[model samples]
Target: MTSFLPTDEEREFIEVAKGFALEKIRPIAREVEDNRIVNDKMVKELEELGFLSREMPEEWEGLELPLISQAQILQALSYGDLAVIQGLPGAGDAASFIRLQKDHPILSLHKEELIQSNKTIALLDLLEVANSQITIEKTENGWMIDGVSQPIRLASFADYVIVAAKDNEGVPVVLWVDIYQDQVKVDSGDYRLGLLASGTGKIIFDQVQISKQLALAEAEDAVKLMADTRNRIRVLQAAKQVGLMEAALDYATEYTAGRKAFGQEIAKFQGVSFRIADMAMETRIAAHLVWEAALAVDGGKNTAAGSSIRALYRAHRSLRFVTDSAVQLLGGHGYVQEYPVEKWMRDAQAQVTLYGRERELLIERGEQILSGAIGVTV
Candidate 1:
């Protein structure tokens, strides 16, 4: 089957991204896994390549590329290193939120900062917010936030943190707090099985005070904003997963063709060859599912449903099948840390789970479908 190919511009960007990954990111993947930190050199190179700002509006110091273009870029970068490339430099998601809420007063204060800052910004992920235990209180000076947020992606590298908390009335409140404040504490050295270089950490906010102007969204608006942003992130994540699956399939195919078993190449066996074929077929399906969702988001169609289907497809089935099968084909070599297929498996699992627990997402998607709430977004 002829899968959709990238446009000329997108192909150019992919090549540039691939070169950057091989030259800059791939060399340090092991070092990052060992050290559990993303170095400044990689961050600088990503910035120089204009990756973090690829989707931001021109007025906000972004390239304002189409969402599909951003997805392609992410896939290319993830082909190099998913962890460091996923959300580095800053909270591009926060920028997207700000873009969605341009009329909000909080955006006025942070517009330039969101665009021009060299420091990364961390947005509290909705999936993991329950662990954060955040609450907001109205004070004479402004709003006070208190909570402990665990395993926030890139919070250690972030100069600013964007949080979505609830007020006494249970209304959602979005707050942008400076990480250097006296009340903020970050335990940045935590380790993980995958995405070790994400700089994930535990953050404690003790009576952090910010002006009322920092409250970015509330009530139903905040809920909707979160849903929208989740869908947006899912699209990019699906694209990255496609890259991971494809890379794994490619590596395994090459390995099986060359490696010998019973005095013959393993690829000669029907069982092994069939599995490779299945991996290719599944990877193609995953890629197309991602594109379907991305095109929906780009066209402002039924994004919620489209994104949900994309997430369900990749998280529940496709990636797991591809990565696990790749491992099976590689046998002992796949399990070794020296070969990257094992790392890819771990990374793929971690990413798919980031949106939510698979069981819960499965139920939610089913409910959405049964309710007929899902439209023909694609």
Candidate 2:
């Protein structure tokens, strides 16, 4: 079946985002992979190019494009490099969440910082330090935060920190604190198996004073917000992986066809050709679901049920196919860092864990949707 191709106008914008990633981000993919710094330079450039401004309102300095546009941008950017895409100078796609603030201080600070950032990035808010273990306390000056946050994406490079803390009422909420002046950020230097450019550091908010606008109306809402953000990230990231996996397949196909093996070119061998076929087919399906979810998001269906299904589609099913099959086609080279497949494989691992682990998210999302259950949103 013929897929829905993008409009010339849409493609034009995509090309702009693509060009930035290809020219600016691709060159640094290796270095970013080798280094711990989530260098914000490329991200800043992309932000300026309007890469992160997907679906944002023009009035708020965002493109207010569409959710599909947002997904496409991330997918293309990931093809060049996800680390650079995420370690963007400020924040992307975070404008809406920031504007949702009724009295959420953290969001207020974030919005202000984003303006200063020139819409360079969409930073991860520091809600639930260490995924809901650490706590933030309201203080006389403003609000005092205590505890360490793990995997602060581009923490060292982030212009602002979106913090999650509890007030005197024990209400879980978000706190937006700027790292440059208000708080101190520490680099963990702990490297991961993949997705390297992200600072992925430990951030400590030691008695940091947060103003009134930084706090969530209800602290308990932090968990919901986290779930929502993770879902969005997962679905969009899946779209990117689809692009990367296809590129890997192309490399395998071209290489195997041209290289001579036992009797003839390896592409003549069913072993080589079949693997490529599977990867290609699986990639198409994944792309569909990724787009479906993006459209769902565009349709305003950001429920856990929807998000979890999308997460399951991408993480457990689509991601698994892309990784395993890509490795199969590459033989030894797939496992070696010399090829980008190895990096792609490692990066794919993050999809499983991010948002919620597949099984956990599956059970939660499945049971609810199957049984027609719904969680109350604040």
Candidate 3:
């Protein structure tokens, strides 16, 4: 019995975001990607528009919007260009951790730098329990972290990093590391696939010693904090993917409608028309799931975590399908740099990889249902 309609305030915010995205962000996407960084002017504009501080706390000079509102705003912005949106500065994924634990002492130590200096932070969440090259070992004072991490968004420019992982003994811990102070190495490797402007790179920790003072949470506290933060992150990421899907669907539909083939518009063909219909349907479904997940998280429902996993999985699948369809519909034009569909497709693939693996998310959701952790809903 929940309404999916936006409130008047939300509607106004979304419209502004949509307009700014299309007018400002879309035009410079190619330039940003080529330069591997968002220009200073665009970054300043985003900050002025409040898009950079949506998840941050008001005490920290942020809008601190709810996940539901943040999701919609992000969706509108991402519709212009997913790569540009992802490249934006400010807390990045670590904002979820800060939002969930605004009062943590460890976080307070860095609040001044983060808010005043506009320092960026990256989240290296190794709690996935998957195969990771990074290792965390317990030390007398705190822990010793070593090895290289998978490519993380915002890594290249991160002033600080929030590490969520387990020790060699499988004890959960969340640590806040000052990258420059700790002398951590950020490897900005050759990245050409997509999201080239996102500052994506690997963080190399060479037996770096972390003091106990930097531990944000440990043991059971860390586990709960990570789980809640992950739910928010998943829903937000899924919302962005839905925006990309919508962009692909709309672009393809418009192109097909105007382009002539065999003395008629290509939209006249059933094959083209049916594919566009499927793209539209898929985009709608992804948006609905993302909205549902955002609501569940905001409501503090037990199903929030499970719903987030499902939402992201579906968004990833639909994003890939929709982007590819856009490319196919445009025929040769789609593959060329002259059109945006090719870049969208590459960005979509990279987005999914950076967020989560499709099969893994599906399996996680299935496990949650079977264990009665979350109920099966229609």
Candidate 4:
């Protein structure tokens, strides 16, 4: 069974993050909601507090905390404000890549501080893919990147993008290029049902320069990188869902326990109490699935629960069901912005779509499982 419970020090770290979330993030969530842009000051504060790079190692100017601990803290932070920083695992994922890919040039070039912040930020920004055709052709200088990248997270905020574009040889190559010229635009079209912190911006790059050091080595690594990163973030996302469901449960419990309806506390009603019971049950399932995914990945037990299959799949599905129940239990209050459950529900919806489409992911997994050429552990 998967478990993400923290040890003594880890618990302390989570408590600190919780305090920051409650004191700072929660208060300004609504303000960001109204303004439709994350406050730069908050981003600076989060960076200054080392909240953005908590899981990176001391070698990279981070705490190198346990993955489980980082998940817990991120869960709390999302509860405070889902709109500001919904993507939480990039710090940890960057640290893992740097630690694993010893000879990688990307890690070799940056200073320690920039290694923690800039590199991680770059990886985080790559979440935007709007069917952009990437062309990476060898040039006299190095490589020229010509393609239209689709709506990306933090598109307006990022100076460069870590892109997986096709090469002249028809190889799906990866490159990092500046986002200058070529009509960079954001589609602030309609407020998403949730996850307001993300700026859905469509990126266009016309004849941008790419250095060899920044491009990923192989055509296949792009797919692997995306799958690897999703598994990492899935655990953290599940943890945040825990916080969201917990908050919603607390809200429902309080309202039902005191608010009288039909001459009785709503909590006294069997229907209300039963829904709470279901929430509790599903929350446990989600927690177990998330922890299973994290430990399985870290321990190299990928066949059992990693590779974005077993545990991540369970966690994502559980997140959807649990948040839906929470929203329903709260009735109309759950739908309005006045209550935080509505925000949590909206954020959960975005989580479903963030890394990749759930439909495509399932199809890919099915095709892999059905292909009998390679040995796979069930």
Best by TM-score: 3
* Ranking 2 against 3 by TM-score, winner: 3
Q: Per-residue lDDT tens digits of candidate 4, residues 157-231?
A: 554455654567666555645455454333444646766666645566567776666675455776566545555
Provide the TM-score for each candidate, comma-separated.
0.88, 0.80, 0.98, 0.82
The candidate, 1 or 2, that scores higher on lDDT is 1
Per-residue CA lDDT of candidate 2, range 154-263, in tens? Answer: 56555566655555566666656667664665656655766666555667666677777655545446767664655565566666666666656666777778878887
Model 3 C-alpha lDDT versus the unseen true structure: 0.91
> Which ten residues in a row are the worst by lDDT in model 1?
125-134
Off by over 4 Å in 2: 1-4, 16-24, 35-41, 92-96, 99-113, 118-131, 137-144, 165-170, 181-184, 207-211, 219-231, 302-313, 370-378
- Per-structure clash totals for the candidates: 0, 20, 0, 3
**Model 2 global lDDT (CA atoms, 0 to 1):** 0.61
TM-score of 1: 0.88
* Angstrom error at residue 278, model 2: 2.1
> In model 1, where do residues sit more than 4 Å from their true spots?
1-5, 102-105, 127-132, 138-142, 312-316, 370-378
For model 3, what is the error of residue 211's alpha carbon versus the real structure, in angstroms, after optimal superposition?
A: 0.7
lDDT assessment of candidate 4: 0.61
Write one digit per residue (lDDT tens) for candidate 3, span 1-378.
Answer: 977788999899999999998999999899999999999999999998888999998988889888888888989999999999999888999998899899999888778988888888999999875899999999999999999999999999898899999999999999988898555899999988999999999999989999998899999999999999999999999999988898889899999999998999999899999999999999999999999999999899988988899899999999999999999999999999989999999999899889988988887788778888777862
In order, candidate lDDTs are: 0.73, 0.61, 0.91, 0.61
Model 4 compared with the native: what TM-score? 0.82
Cα misplacement distance, residue 183 of candidate 4 (Å): 7.1
Model 4 Cα shift for residue 222 (angstroms):
5.3
